[model samples]
Target chain A: MGIQLDFPAVLERWPSFLGGAALTLELAALATMFGALLGTLAAVGRGTHNALIAGACKVYVETIRNTPLLVQIFLVYFGLASLGLKFSAFTVAVAALTINVGAYTAEIMRAGFEAIPRGQIEAAEGLALSRVQIYWHIILLPAVERVYPALTSQFVLLMLASSVCSQISAEELTAIANYIQSDTYRAFETYIIVAVLYVILSLVMRAGFWGLGLVLFPRRRRLGTPL
Target chain B: MQQNTSSEPIVSLRDVQKSFGPLKVLDGVSFAVDRGEVLAIIGRSGSGKSTALRCIDRFEKVDGGEIMVCGHRVDRPDVDLRALRQDVGIVFQSYNLFPHLTIEQNITLAPCAVKKMATGQAKELARKVLAQVGLEEKLHAYPEQLSGGQQQRAAIARSLAMQPKVMLFDEVTSALDPELTGEVLKVIEQLAADGMTMVMVTHEMGFAKSIADRIVFMHRGKVHESGPASILTSPTTPELRQFVGTGNLKS
Candidate 1:
């Protein structure tokens, strides 16, 4: 027999897989919200007339984008340890993922911000909207609406990439799968099940994001075009 | 109208100069509009008429000279932009309504955010302005859903909601089709009839002649001719004659 199927062994250990998946989702959710906030701020910073703030934001985006996610996670995990700062792997994973996704989010958000017509900002300015008001109501909200699809995809990718947290023993889905596979001696079946779970998680994420998009961007929902 | 009675100018730009790198767009341009006067600036493309209107709103900072609108020194470095803008409203050729908001929301945004009006109070103001623009029914509709004329009207309503001391229209109807242009012009005419102080940069000679208390014709980045609306009928300057003649030829 070239190979044998033993999905039952993996399926019987559903509690561990379910817990791992739940933890993975929690990590993704935290990273997504925090990352989006950080990215949007960074994008705004990059657009500012102040050279120093803009330059710093540019450097942050470039450094993260240039480095591999695996290396970032390792650095975050071990760097904190080397500095004598004790932290759980889960905390490290979320921080690393947030930092990583924040960079990608910043780039996408910058594109969205750039796409806003100059007239809109001028109009807001003419209406006496303060700088912060203009940014919140006119620029940031519309920019996010414009790049929502890209943002959601980035989040889904972040969720999948969260699997890399297993290297730091983060006890997420992949880590649980590794434990289950070794215990049950059903490596092939365990991996296949985990893969299917991942696909299902991604599908659920897409559905959630699509719903969130409809709620967050009523204009887009009504017209099928970002405002 | 205030031009006929009041001596005070709500908007005054004196020797305002502006340039884009090496290109001088507005050279020593000066104009004033009284509390209820409708001053129309008309000229060919690249005549700096639009730039002058923008300077009154502080949308474009003058490279030199003075601009004072509604008691604010626009040319001064210490001038408060928000305060100056609150005293003036400017609408552009493109109806730059916030695409993400409904007509009502767009109208109410300034009043609520800038003026610090409560949401309910802002909504009432929105309803009133939308009614003024004859677009009360479109209160809930987003900008993209409206026609070009409707969007421009909504843009006007949005500005009107601010209740500025003066309003500036930068070729607001130039982007519309002939049929669509009529509706936007009608809204402006209605506002003028209500004695709203206004300055407009327009190419519509008939509309301008009918509504404008005074017309300033810019040629080669300077006010080549300035007088009553009758200037369109009897131009003292040959440049204005040629300008109006060509304008009539185009239409």
Candidate 2:
């Protein structure tokens, strides 16, 4: 007899699957916000004239980018535990995802910063703008607008990778799938549903980022030119 | 005709020396612009005309020299750059208007950020300066939307909103075609007619001859000759004669 599929058994745990998807999104959102901030700072710090600060920023970016995200999650999870620090699995997942995404973001943001023309900074200086004013108005804002697409894609990728948190039993979508599959003995159907949810999550994140980009860089929309 | 010999110069550079490693860009360059006077510096591409103009604004730190502008000593390390820039307005050939900002925003940026003017006040100032540049209609347009000449005019408007004591033009029309160059020069002529103290480094010898109070011919990183507008026609030095001979200066 042919093997029969049993999607109904997996579909019975829709509430658990819904809760898992919500947690996955929450983790991704928290990690993205913190990662963007960390990345922008590191990008600026790396471009600074101070050798020590720039060197430190460079080392952080290179080290995190070269290693696998799985290794980083393990290091943060086990390393913090060994250091006598206690935290929930969710916290550890968010922290590891943030750290992982921050490095990738720094590299992307550095390219954005590098793309700004030297003349723009010189013109700002000529206007007698203070250092802070120049950085915010002339350098950072336009640079971010120019690289908005690349940045949003990175965020989307981070959201998909958050599923790796399932290994630590962080109770995300994949972890929920693992539990439901074992209980119902419908492993294939459980994983297929989980994959669909992840895809939906990524599409939602992309739409959200695109909307944010439109608001943040309205000039690009108006002029059909990169800000 | 603009020789008012009694008043103090608003901008002065004496024995200014600048070197790029081994290449000496400016060697003992000295000049001065009296109040409301228009001094034009003319020379070939690498004659250090641009360097001398940049030094007055402290854009390039002079290796050795005394540079003063509007009573501020520019060559000294302790000189406040922000204050110096406040008193000086400069426009470049490329017209470096911020691409992200609108024309009004470009004009109002300095007055708003540096001078801390209110948004309403800055907008009013932008209106006035944009009008002066004959670009009142382009207040909401982006830099990329404007033609090269319009972009350059907007740059001048942006500088004028600062209300600087002196204006510096570094080949402001070198990037424009002849027809577009005329429109920009017209705005500058109006500025001169209004008695603004100005110094310009230009290849447009014709415009220099017509509007400049005096001209300094730079050659081989030094002042080859300095005299009134008549020098463009007379050309006492051989370098000036050769420079005038080139078709680029068709006065």
Q: Model 2 chain A: which ten-residue window has the lowest total lDDT?
A: A218-227
DockQ of each two-chain model: 0.87, 0.76
Score every model by TM-score: 0.97, 0.96
Can you tell me which runs of candidate 2 are displaced by over 4 Å?
A: A1-3, B1-7
Model 1, A87-195: lDDT tens per residue? 9999999999999999999999999999899999999999999889999999887888888889899999999999999999997999999999899999989888889
Candidate 1: residue pairs that collide = none
Estimate the TM-score for candidate 1: 0.97
Instruction: Point out the worst 10-residue segment of candidate 1 chain B by lDDT.
Output: B1-10
Model 1 lDDT vs. the true structure?
A: 0.90
Candidate 2 lDDT: 0.90
lDDT of 1 at A214: 81
Go through the candidates in order and give the clash count of each: 0, 0
